[model samples]
Target: MINLKMILRIMGILSLIEAVLLLLCAGVSLIYGESIINDFLMVAAGSVIFGGLLLLMGKGASKQLNRRNGYLIVTLSWLLFSAIGMFPFLISGYVPRVVDAFFETMSGFTTTGATVIDNIESLPHGLLFWRSLTQWAGGLGIIFFTIAMLPLFGMGSMHLFSAEATGTSHERLHPRISITAKWIWYVYFGLTLALTLFLLLGGMNLFDSICHSFSTISTGGFSTKKASIAYYSSPYIEYVISIFMILSGINFTLFFYLAKGKPQKALLNEELKWFLKSIIVFTAIFTVTLTYTSPYGVGESFRKALFQVASLHTTTGLVSADYMVWTPFLWALLGVIMFLGASSGCTSGAIKSIRLLILGKMTKNEFKRMVHPNAVLPVKINKIAISPSTQSSVLLFILLYMIIFVASWLAMMAMGVGNVEAFGTVVSSMGSVGPGLGLCGPVHSWNCLPDGGKWLLSFLMLIGRLELFTVLLLFTPQFWKKR
Candidate 1:
């Protein structure tokens, strides 16, 4: 049976943590001398009260959690965080509609980076900071963030980690899961700080540097300016963000190994090797295309190609130039990149590189088996044979991912969205990548979409951010049956 009381208690703790984050934004408001401080404070107060009530109701609950409780808790927690996270926007009249507020908040927490706001710079510094914070906090994951603290509260994090952690295999840098989380956070924080310093040196102000650093390290594309990185028009800024976006797309566990003086182990990762190779290949293709077709010279084309390829490949969604106006072939290539996504266990979303790596191996093995009916050919990754179950799981995941994409694409078209826009939006939403083709392109906000479309995309973002099965499994009838 599900551990209902324990789930409530844990959610209460999460709400309190969220309240603290809100207060930090309020502090930012104070620093900026913005009157929106009251809006943040009011929401923070509400979070505290709501959290307190949950704690009271969950008093004396058993601490034990099963797989069922873990999945349910993770899904509900995301919804709960989004529900509470929307209030500051609502109270401040920034995102006036309930659907708009929820969609924006969900996008922030999921690091999807889609926005409805036309004038991003007009928002107060505090709200912008909060918006970036949501992405940064969610970069690794919500449950993963509290793993270190979960043990302090007399709870084990194994089930939670199993349910919510990304990638096909969980890497353990340390024997203790909490220690592993801390080590990963150390890498995450260090990268964010390094990127911030680079942006500052590139002539960006401290606030913009910090905010963009948050978005970049999280592979989130929220910008403090209206025109995104294009507003700066600095080649140096573009290159720096491009490099950092690629770095952030790497699996955090690999960074841990490098940090621990095991450079060979990290360097030998097959997925990392393939991911880098893919970037170089895509960048080269883009550079050649833009160099010949556009007014940009080879150097400028290379710069733009590197930035755009790295951005979308990592699902960062920070646009240097609008890709929609590019050759149809180029934007189509970017759509494929968005679908492929970055390395697993990092900030970005979509079908991760590790899975793709496995899928490629599986396809190869199938062909080999066809050649020799009696011979056994096992799929391998990084020189280790992949289990049959894992191979099947990867295949099933890709199938379901495509199935949902088709279904959602049709649904969007039925909702009065144009064919091109509908296709782009569904792919973008399902992959948790910001910007779409046509009307919802990088230059435009998603405000043109109907309320129903926004809500549908919001659901897509949640499921995508949770890696498909975690959220989808909750809807299955068998998932609710007592074991």
Candidate 2:
């Protein structure tokens, strides 16, 4: 039922492209006089050789990718890419442990901002740039890259796109998926470029600005400095980053509509409304709490509250302040925000607010049904009644998400992680929210996590980014059944 040859062929091509990108990283190393150039080159060469063999062997194969094959390909592609992605770190001896390297690569590809490297400033600029680039690539999605550039896949593109695309809904801005992919990336690239320029103007070096821009637009939140945004202490820079993070979390499809003079459509979208409302409500609460209870001035409290709420809600994980030291109430508030994530169909990760909104409405309708059994009520989004199938799918997805989250949390606890740390890491990893509350908190890294915990969290990150069904379906017997 799955096209193995076609999957391998696409993987080969993707690997080859990744290898080429690594070579560019090697150039950066050389230009910056970094010592890891040879190591990077060696890894790049191996990628090319391995990919070349697959390409040659799978040459002339049919390009069509069915649904089953698409999921298999995406899952395997991420795994394979992570494997090869670890080579540079391995060869450079920067990361001696294979597990740590794999975890880092997984984080990059998943666009999860968690890191094992504690001394980020100690790493070379080239490696840092490559790290940021991986997130940028992963942010829009590797499948999207393939879809936009590799036209031969045609109908197969939808299969891969469905597996990789975020959100409970998918939209095609153009009739052709390839064209749609290009438009998404065009917006993605434009935002990244604009953010880079703004950061540079705000007094960041070209290298730091570019890296930060990549991370910001991707909503990946990897900082070159050890202190993150705190290192700069520049209000202007923080404001700019907050704006882009919020923008990056929004559905790019809406931007396209706005570009086409369909601003009303974006405004009328239920998800957008919920997104804005959530930010406003949370910001207000956080501001009130911080201003009244904390030592900071009202203005300072508002700034901190708004920044943290935006960061966590968008799942960007950029820390402008040490949130752990904040009041317990504020800490708990942020923890909840981690699960809220940003808009679907964007780079942000979590159980999207739209699904939650639908579930809420569905729950309310069910309650009403108890009083009037003969009456009919429909769950509506954007003023349209959702079909039964879509509603069922959303409900199933939420259940699966909860199961995965609980299981992950329990696993972490079993691994000897403290309750606070376990809950934070599991939820944050599953939500693709980088920082947690305790050991993996905003001020901390997962470098000290046990190997088992690192691997488990890595898997969770992958599943979360793909959304539950795409990854969980891989485990079902029916998924493997021949059609």
TM-score top scorer: 1
385-441 per-residue lDDT for model 1 (tens digits): 989888888988999999999999999999999998998888888887888888888
On the 0 to 100 scale, the lDDT of residue 155 in model 2 is: 37
Which sections of candidate 1 miss by over 4 Å? none
State the lDDT of candidate 2 residue by residue for 183-260, as single tens digits: 998899999999999999999999899888888888887889777888999888888898888898888899999899
TM-score computed on alpha carbons, candidate 2:
0.97
Alpha carbon lDDT at 311, candidate 2: 85
Candidates in order, TM-scores: namely 0.99, 0.97
